[model samples]
Target: MAQEPDPERLRALEARLAEAKGSKAKPAAAGKDFSQAEVAWRMVLELTSGIMIGGSIGYGLDYLFGTRPILLIVFLLFGFAAGIRTVMGTARDMQERQLRAQAIETQAEHSAGTEG
Candidate 1:
């Protein structure tokens, strides 16, 4: 006579299978759900922070040197330039990351196709 299967073990196996199926469907939806607003906000934050930090440093230096306005104005402009540079750098980095991610995904698909 064949041995009876354990109900507890069978339930555990079913639960694992369901969990695996659920997980496989989530990542695609998560990727699609990513918003452009997030990227915009990230760049804005980077640019704003750079400008603020540079301006503060310039102001401090001006105060220390007892120069009323010249260094402050110069450093403020420098800070604005720095902020723009930072935003551009951030944009480039983001593009690179996106390209890398796409390349990885393409490679994965190719390998999967070959294997199948």
Candidate 2:
């Protein structure tokens, strides 16, 4: 013979399922609040990638020409300098934009106070 589920148990299970479905889960935090050190770390990673890529290309050229060490060293140093400059420039630009925003906000507040 077949058996039926108890109505009370079925109701309780339904309630639990409904509650679970209705609850909202928080979104995971992305790495948006990176500190200066962390930003530098990321910059270093980019620099390292650039160095590796440039070195690889240089290695290929050197192998074709039978020259060693010269091309790899030059390209890696160039890549490192370029990466540091790019990162520093970005940090500066971010600071400038923030300053401009603050200035605009201050101006607005001053104007509003004068008017009212």
Candidate 3:
């Protein structure tokens, strides 16, 4: 005949299952944390790429027009302006994100304070 399961063993299994589920329910915090260095690097890359792309386009135009230094100089300045604009945009985005994060943290704290 088949035997019945023991009550103690069933409780132990349920406890372990609940513990595992609880652990998994917590959000993964590792990916969200961006260090200052990483943020700076991201901004720097954005600016650099903008400048490089602008400079390349300018260089190509100068070569096509046979204007030599004139177009090159103009384009280089344009590229610098474009890069500054991109960097400013990146800074604004980062600021907005930081504000939102702070708001969330503040809300969470307020809720916790109210609960206790």
TM-score, cand. 2 vs. native:
0.55
TM-score of each: 0.60, 0.55, 0.69
**Which candidate's TM-score is highest?**
3
Tens-digit lDDT track for model 1 on 1-97? Answer: 9999999998788778878887422333335423579878977887888778878887898899998677778877888888889889978877887
User: How do the residues 48-76 of candidate 3 rate in per-residue lDDT, one tens digit apiece?
Assistant: 88778877887899889888778777877
In model 2, which regions exceed 4 Å deviation?
1-42
Candidate 3 residue pairs in backbone clash? none
Give the CA lDDT, 0 to 100, for residue 87 in model 3: 84
Candidate 2 residue lDDT tens string, 1-116: 89988999987877787788985333254224447787678777877877777788778878888889888788778777777777788788668766866996799789889999
Index of the highest-lDDT prediction: 3
lDDT of each: 0.79, 0.75, 0.81
lDDT of 3: 0.81
Each candidate: how many clashes?
0, 0, 0
